[model samples]
Target: MEISGSAFNSGLNAIQAGQRRVDQAATEIASNTLPQAPVETPPAQQVNPSPSGAANTQADLAESLVALNVGKTEVQAGAKVVETADEVLGTLIDTRA
Candidate 1:
């Protein structure tokens, strides 16, 4: 049994459409929104700006502040881990020699 060209194309189209719908639904459910790939970020959503650029600026500032705090936390955690490892290595060397 062989399918014609048009039938094959229609089947492929249905498969593609199903895949897109699944992708969209997955995005909506995860991460408050899922951007399929982190390397290609979605553009920021635009809010009304006739009179409230201040609010937008403030929001951007707030997002930066939170991000900065998270970065600081990770740095602190990494430092602690490195420090512990250094101390262990020093002790091992002292005991070996």
Candidate 2:
């Protein structure tokens, strides 16, 4: 088995991508959870809260949470790949001595 620079580069890229994903998801979740001022409704019209709107927000929150978890897993896997590549390269160098 041979380990090369490409393997290291791929791992690094994966780690970077995963980190970006995690960051984006966290930002989204934060924004979604922020409190908003209540809007005043006219006395003549009764305002009914849309259940669908609430459901949509909940769905988005769920998706963001999932993305966050997936990103963490991706980073861990990438780190392992990089670690394995480094170990293999070190062993190869040691055998040459």
Candidate 3:
């Protein structure tokens, strides 16, 4: 019994995708955890273009949460692909024996 090239390639791709997802999640977590720099305001300019620094922080937190969820989903899907590939290979080996 011989393994097809496509299956081998797919397994590699799945592993790479899973690693990428994990890396992305770590990066997002680190960046979100860092303290944000204080916004500068001039005494003469009373009006601010944005609502407030707090609002920006809230938005960043929301975006980070979304990214984390997406990253978790991607990693899970990739793991599944790799698991399926391993199972198929194992079955092939069993049959050969």
Candidate 4:
């Protein structure tokens, strides 16, 4: 089946967006400076608690890595779609000529 140019453009756009997300995630992971989500504790449960920076950081890192992996997969899929579209278009043009 043939794909339109707009479809190909959309695929390329997806690739660009996915790459940006992957890069941002990598940078955050490498720098270890991701912003932490505020931890909320009920007043009743607020019994003196020790600092949890280490735990928070570990959880954040894990989440960031997962996001990075997902972004990488998106980029790969987008690139494949664009590639296939290009090939199909090329074949169509050749056939027309």
Candidate 5:
């Protein structure tokens, strides 16, 4: 099945949104003082890309897809981080206010 542009766009937007959430989470976490503070790894750090093609377009496409999937996983992990941060922030703010 061919993917429509709109569908692709939707997916991209969702990914972007998730990334934003993750960033917000990390920021919130950074602002607080806690025991055993978690080490947050950025998405780019998790993915390593090597050129997969030797003057071959097919191999290039495969490499690109691998990179894309890796990116998606990073974004997902980020989203989880964001959610965790959001929850912590909410609790703190509620207690302080």
Candidate 6:
């Protein structure tokens, strides 16, 4: 029972952590998409921004996307842990009875 309780707690914690990661990645993706240029900036300047800045944004976006996928996987794993814990507890109970 104690072990199952611990596992359930661990699963819940993992699920929460994954949810946080998902939220952060989503926010980053939203903020990074199609950044707005200043109104006063010339059309030619807007067309050709600094190479380093553009590269950085692309890298950040890629990282965020990866984080999103990782978060999804974590959530799935956490759910499995919780399920297995529940099954173990059930088996123990049945055996004792």
- The candidate maximizing TM-score is 2
Model with the higher lDDT, candidate 2 or 3: 2
Better of 2 and 3 by TM-score: 2
- Candidate 3, number of clashes: 0
Compared with the true structure, all predictions reach lDDT values of 0.50, 0.87, 0.69, 0.85, 0.55, 0.91
How well is each residue in 1-97 modelled by candidate 2, as lDDT tens digits? 4345887988999999999999999998997788877777777785665578678889999999999999999999899989988988888889997
Summarize candidate 1's per-residue lDDT along 38-79 as a digit string, tens digits: 343345644432547546655655665555455455445545
TM-score of each: 0.44, 0.85, 0.64, 0.74, 0.40, 0.84
lDDT of 4 by residue, 56-82 (tens): 888988988998998999899899889
Ranking by TM-score: 2, 6, 4, 3, 1, 5
The list of candidate 5 runs beyond 4 A from truth reads 1-55
Minimum summed lDDT over a 10-residue window in model 1 is located at: 1-10
Q: List the residue pairs that clash in candidate 6.
A: none
* Candidate 4 residue runs with Cα over 4 Å from true position: 1-3, 33-51
RMSD of 5: 20.1
lDDT of 5 by residue, 1-97 (tens): 1233344445556668656655655444443324454567687895654444234545544555555565567677655555655666677678889
Ten contiguous residues minimizing lDDT sum, candidate 4: 1-10
Better of 4 and 5 by TM-score: 4
For candidate 2, what is the lDDT?
0.87
TM-score of 6: 0.84
Ranking by lDDT: 6, 2, 4, 3, 5, 1
The lDDT, on a scale of 0 to 1, for candidate 3 is 0.69
Q: Whole-model lDDT for model 1 versus the true structure? A: 0.50
Better of 3 and 5 by lDDT: 3
